[model samples]
Target: MAALQGAVETTAPVSRLHEQRSYDPADFGVPTGREEEWRFTPLRRLRGLHTDAPLPGGKVTVECDPAPEVTVENIERGNRRLGTAYVPADRVSARAFTSFAEATVVTVPRGVVASRPTVISVRGDDPAGAVFGHVVVELEPLAQAVVVLDHTGSATYADNVELIVGDGATLAVVSLQDWASDTVHLSHHHAQVGRDARFTHTAVTLGGSVVRLAPSVRYAGPGGEAELRGLYFADAGQHLEHRLFVDHGERNCRSRVTYKGALQGADAHAVWIGDVVIRAEATGTDTYEYNRNLVLTDGTRVDSVPNLEILTGEVVGAGHASASGRLEDHHLFYLMARGIPYDEARRLVIRGFFGQLIAQIEVPELHARITSAVEAELA
Candidate 1:
């Protein structure tokens, strides 16, 4: 419901962090949930990742498989491409950046098309400690590849991920959060699109005590394209949040974003925030963002916010929409009227809602897993 055409200035020091971008953790201070960005988040469940508390170690295990056309390495933080995609935009992200000594970097050479997907598996070893990690993905000119980040187990974890897509290159990234019921995770993903490049970001969140993921994109050159998609399920007493921001500063760029979530049981909560900004110089831009949330039962809560700011009237088009509500009784009645069982009818409706996005992934194994997870949630 909120939109801004120009920069917003605030008097409070904590409020300024919402607009400031920095790599130093000191610049953000600590969030009190009163700031514009953190108001919807449950900061008390973050396990001190935002404050001066120490970031625990040895709580997470990460493994990666190197592909023939792609190179994966645990490089020192001094690597030139470490922060090329994005810098820390908040306190937790800044803390994560400062805590990790090395970053996992995946690089695809120029003009090379990867034959197989590069998979990174991250699992929590214990639930008592906190973990901080970083990941960087770089694609050279005309390169194409897919990267999957699979996370599971139980722990307090925070991470920063960056993706750099070069001119004419294509990159797709999938982040799956299937954790233990008690796990807590916070992550920030940033992507930079080069001239004529293509980027796709997908997120699947199904577990955790409190999980929040922020994915942002900025055009590095003209004619870039970005697609962002997400799906999540929230159970009783669980909190899930996904926030996205796309900044179009170059000419002739295009972006599309779609996110859908389902919630059931008492006290389950889901939040989605989508923001798109088109600068005055971003002529010939085309963008649309939408979010849909399905409340499957009583006592569950959903908050959806979609915002678009256009500083130029020369842009091709720009728009955003958000919808949150329970399933329609007419849909169920229509199906049951054909002699179909109630349970089967409900399942069909749920599947149909998410089928479009799932099919877009084009990965059968992932699709199966997502459906199975949702079925288990419904059971």
Candidate 2:
């Protein structure tokens, strides 16, 4: 419920890693719920993804229908293109990296524009087994494309996704997590934006037992732009968490982030953590992040934190906003005064709250589907 608009200065030598990124899982200690990173998480529910337990893989399936101009491949661990655009910053991410058997790669050729969006589906068949996965999406120089990533079914899943946006290219990605009620999923998506490229990513998470997602962005050269947006609704006993980081290391770059969520029923929890760091050399960087949460019931809880770190005062502008509270009583009163039933008025308020964000995405089908899903949740 706090908003941070200023910068923080460091005097002595600081760690090179922003959040202690590492490739080896052994570099990270197991979680005991005492560390700052794991404080808000329920560690006992992770089912050994953070520990040394065996990741024998599970009944996980991946299906992709790529555009004619795109190339899709199933690559092994030693593939040259692997790990080129991302690094793991947490224990689960490192574990998913080292344990995933294969990686799915979707590539859009240089200078080619895809006519249709590329669709990829990841589903789990067994809730008892564990799944570790890796996904890579690349757009070469001057290429343009859209990617749709959907997840469903149930399992204990952890994975990492890499997005490479080349120079002067434009890339849009929509990631949807509609898992079953018994599913537990953890994922991290990182984007490497090249010079003058544009990248947009939207995350829609509506169902899960325990889901945690991290999306991050970094610039490879100057003039790159990135936008991250998300929406989620949690029911009783469902926990949804999203953490985002933007590293502005290049000059004249721009980044924006906005996320909104709603919670209902008892014991529903949501967490949002947004961090933006503007380095000293990153002059003329313009960035802003925002998050808002709505509590539809009494037993639900939410935690929203927005942080900004500007190492140099020469930047263009930087700021953030975060707020969490119940629905505005005046808005409801205004609707109820029109002869609308109490329940119908509540639905209208919630719909208007999320409909704005849903319309921001360029995809058409997602707009309708998410609206229908929200209506079902309200019912």
Candidate 3:
């Protein structure tokens, strides 16, 4: 680790270029395996990768059938900011910092409603090195759009992304993380909602050696709404963790979060932490969060912590719930006695567990794709 640090410090030209054109891992305060937030995660797994961050050579492609009438821009060389906060050095870990970059920017003008989904695909080849990329979204007042982000790598690398949505706009953002077998992924997504704006985020994690996804959203204006939805599967010895924070900074705002996971095989571990905060001035706030996990093997483990903090008494409603357990024997037996194959029966039960949330997606094609991917991973 020290050698890698020294290499980054010694490479003056590359370091300067990274600073001028892209996000530096060092700026985010990469973890040294000593921080409390990183205690549960294994840091030694990143020892083999090259410490020096790679240039933004990865290819980013966008596709939208029946494309939107609004202007679509692909920003190749530009500084993209995620909301108003700069990348604080102490808040970022070394591994997490390597994956930061200024992503392509997409802007939707006010009052424009897109007719099709916008698909953004990013691909990289530095499996043994570090890869960084970013995607910036700005929606004008009364604008409506659906954006899909798909991340995949040919080699093992850490990935990071930052997203921003504007005021009085509605953005339906979906993210899919599919990395190589030996890949280690660390992702950070930060979003801000403006007055009367709506932001919906849905994430599906299906492949990676070790994956940690953290999404932080803030409702900074009155009457704004934010919704977070996610589905994950950890099989065999994989480790997957998701942490979400929703901040209500204004009055008359609402937020809802629901995340579910399935764990199978020994040493498969999954962790979920949901945190919601209603500020003192945030009156008429409504928030709720729930996390559920289904354990298929005795050796598998899951830890869930759902929390809510209210600083004012004028809030309308707030609550949180968490549950972690195995499949009920009665439900399994009943399925088997009905002549269903054991494997098929187990698959049915797992699908039903996530089906409720999957059914909530407004897009038919997206809903079907998510369901098929979950089935394939669990099967």
For candidate 2, what is the TM-score?
0.95
lDDT of 1 by residue, 24-110 (tens): 999986899987778878888887888886755657888887568898889776677677678889999988888877789999999
Ranking by lDDT: 2, 1, 3
Error of 3 at 183 (Å): 2.0
Off by over 4 Å in 2: 1-19
lDDT of 3 by residue, 266-367 (tens): 888787767787888999999999888887776776767665777889998899877777777788899999999888888899989999878876565877
Candidate 1 weakest lDDT stretch, 10 residues: 1-10
Q: Go through the candidates in order and give each one's C-alpha lDDT.
A: 0.86, 0.87, 0.68
Query: What TM-score does each of the candidates earn?
Result: 0.94, 0.95, 0.83
lDDT of predicted model 2? 0.87
Which is better, 1 or 3, measured by lDDT?
1
Provide the lDDT at 161 for model 3: 47
With candidate 1 superimposed using the best TM-score fit, by how many Å does residue 13's alpha carbon deviate from the native?
Answer: 17
Residue-pair clashes per candidate: 0, 0, 11
